[model samples]
Target chain A: MKLRRSERMVVISNYLINNPYKLTSLNTFAEKYEAAKSSISEDIAIIKKAFEESGIGEIETVTGASGGVIFTPGISEEEARSVIEDLRDSMSESNRILPGGYIYLSDLLSTPRILQSVGRIIANAFKGNKIDAVMTVATKGVPLANAVANILNVPFVIVRRDLKITEGSTVSVNYASGSSDRIEKMFLSKRSLKPNSRVLIVDDFLKGGGTISGMVSLLTEFDSTLVGVAVFAENAQEKRDRMNYKSLLKVSEIDVKSNHVKVELGNIFDK
Target chain B: MKLRRSERMVVISNYLINNPYKLTSLNTFAEKYEAAKSSISEDIAIIKKAFEESGIGEIETVTGASGGVIFTPGISEEEARSVIEDLRDSMSESNRILPGGYIYLSDLLSTPRILQSVGRIIANAFKGNKIDAVMTVATKGVPLANAVANILNVPFVIVRRDLKITEGSTVSVNYASGSSDRIEKMFLSKRSLKPNSRVLIVDDFLKGGGTISGMVSLLTEFDSTLVGVAVFAENAQEKRDRMNYKSLLKVSEIDVKSNHVKVELGNIFDK
Candidate 1:
């Protein structure tokens, strides 16, 4: 007996979710269903369109010989919040994350699987939102931006903390980050973004949300809109709102001088 | 008449090269050849494996009910030099690239198609090199690193100009970049790389070879071996006879403060 289209999609999505590295070709699906190749093709097109429309997963096609589709695991916003909370739980156990009242995420960001999963969850939250680009302040934010951009297939623009010989003339924006008394200048090339582009702002960590706001102001110079802001980790003690933004993990406070800290996972990755 | 494995591989590869975006499935190939689905599937497997072994292009699979394979266009090292030389020819028409004794690649790096081709060519040069990682300095190098990493399926790592709160404790190194007066500091997290890793260094441009040397030194601290070095452009003048690396385009010289420049395609893409 042949399965209904809905049934097939569910089965296929489940298969992709479980077998992350495995790829399947159309012939394989057709044989499994005892359906005509043409019908299978139609069914896949439907599934792909559904995935795109639903914004839960991405279906990539491989052509020529040895081609198959791999389903990337994605989560809805509510589900994403739970996952972030889980990571927060894991992070809170480590006393090393707080040294001098700061949440250290360098080790967390460097791990591939964590970054990959975090990236997917974050990207899924804004699927099909027509984000013109992903932007981040340079260095630490590059990898996070890269992961998000890869999932969305959009270009990632890195804003420099300082000018380099290669960057030519840059439009500089001034913003204070953390407890630094002096205002720091962040720069993006005038030509990096097009006019009226919609940008998704992402960063590894948020302390005061000052850098995030500065990026927002920077985007305005290009007439770009800020569609969303996401951070892998955020600290609530900073008393900065923009609670409007999505964060995977939230750190309430850290007493580095005393080596004590508190953490709260935002409800972003509920699953 | 049905096409044999060799014949199909060539034709399919050529088709992928020409069409670029259009992906045809095994079922489609079977229908085109009047062969059974099984036979076509087998043929595709062979082709995909061959691409992996030969490094001509990538065979990406699209799984699920209607998923199929797609070809991502890639070039060989020989082809890389040819394309680079073409760009070199165009860049040399005027001294525009040599403004202030530097070949400005900001405009080129920002261009999508150019970056795409450059990435493919570099990937080709390193095809089958067993590269474990792609490493680059921050900012402009990120785009090029992304392209090479995507094709190679290796993680790309970025070295920071300066450490931030997110980077944890960083291991810093100093190196002279070409003939520059000042010593530049490059940094990486102590744990970001494993000891004795095989790394491929990729950058957008090379001037004094100082940055490349710095990257090499940083890798050495982790006991990492330099597998190879690739750049989109290289300086032809003041050539270092002892260095082993590949550049897509070779720059002869740029008259100081003039828009005059000369360049040629490097031998890495000799074919």
Candidate 2:
């Protein structure tokens, strides 16, 4: 499909935006759009300028026989901080506090706009690292993991607490359920992940870090390496062993009696 | 940040691509780009042409006091058919059949590119309908629902088989489990969805139709309306009560003993 230079750039930018972290040869675009290689090269240069100027992402041109352009999605630090601050404000709402001091986060995590922004922030923090996949435990963490994985253009492996017949064979690990303090099993389908994968772990909330620890152990069981960990929110009041992770929001206080909650930007922005 | 007209068009097109199904005033773009409203309007015209010509989507200008442009994502018939055909081929793999005639779908659902394409196809099927939210059962259906929600720019609600404190107060309903021939309960967080919402239900697989029914009932309980139901795949051999839905792939036969499965395109393509 031949297109004008402007229209070609629009569609090419769209393709690159959709397929982030992917390398596509300029020849592919040239042939698809019926444009010369040099024209496609010019298109990429303009797209790169627009993308970088808008802080949408960076487009890297790899030069070699097998080289191509790679688009990496990113967010400006100002935008990221503002997004987190808005989240912190929403999370501080008094009604979000449950009876047992647990702050309700389902609403926040379920929203697409919020999830997309949070995904950008977390993925940007670990931008230079080689991440093959994103990992998370079942239920709450699935969406968070999916968000990050979408930005990274990688598959997400969900570790479930209950085994289903459809999963076939799975590898299981035991972890202490921080809320219940009960030893429970978390399962990941054996075929879900590959060995030697560098995975980034993501979750909706972090408290005692027991679940993340469990996932870390499971990664070892699968011979996968942990690139890093990130969470949507963390309970700052909970005292636990130091775990290296980035969080977008920190819930410093949740007083159920007074119906008050205190929230702050998490360590994700820390230098 | 001011930009050249071509650069502005690139960024404006990117914004509309990311924020599908939502109306944005030209003034917003004009102010952001430091361009005249007429320039932004001209930019939208070119983007609309580029988007429609490329099968990316359609941009409709709503003219009124509360007027703006709304982008509705779309995929070409050829592209959609090819995507489903690819999925059918993958689903037909003999090794995908498990002991109980269940086909493993974790790998397909976890891949970002596949999920995004499937999401586009499903969302496009329900185009023109007001979809305030996407709904699905937990574990397997979360990613599919998330994908659709992302395309629609709406939040997704997860119906879970088991209750967790993190979800806070929830509304529970009972549904029959087709595989086990047993009745089971499903729960949705009370605060996750707003009342009177128009929801689109989505799932990874459709064998029983019970889970989708349960979600429909839950929607009624919340005083919400069901706009439609769409699934990634459905079992044709399994006898199920007529359920109104669209599925991308239909499994006509799953012969575990013979290690073969018959797959076909589903009703989603039906006129």
Q: Score the docking of each candidate (DockQ).
A: 0.10, 0.87
lDDT of each: 0.69, 0.92
> What CAPRI grade goes to candidate 2?
high
Task: Score every model by TM-score.
Answer: 0.68, 0.98
lDDT of 1 by residue, A94-123 (tens): 555534566656555544445556878887
- Model 1: DockQ score: 0.10
TM-score of chain A of 2: 0.98
Name the lDDT value of residue A107 in candidate 2.
87
Candidate 2: the clashing residue pairs are none
Runs in model 1 lying further than 4 Å from the true structure:
A1-98, A107-119, A252-271, B1-99, B107-120, B253-263
Q: Which model scores highest in DockQ? A: 2
Give, for candidate 1 chain A, the lowest lDDT window spanning 10 residues: A13-22
Give me the displacement of residue B186 in model 2, in angstroms.
0.8
Chain A of model 1, TM-score against the native?
0.72
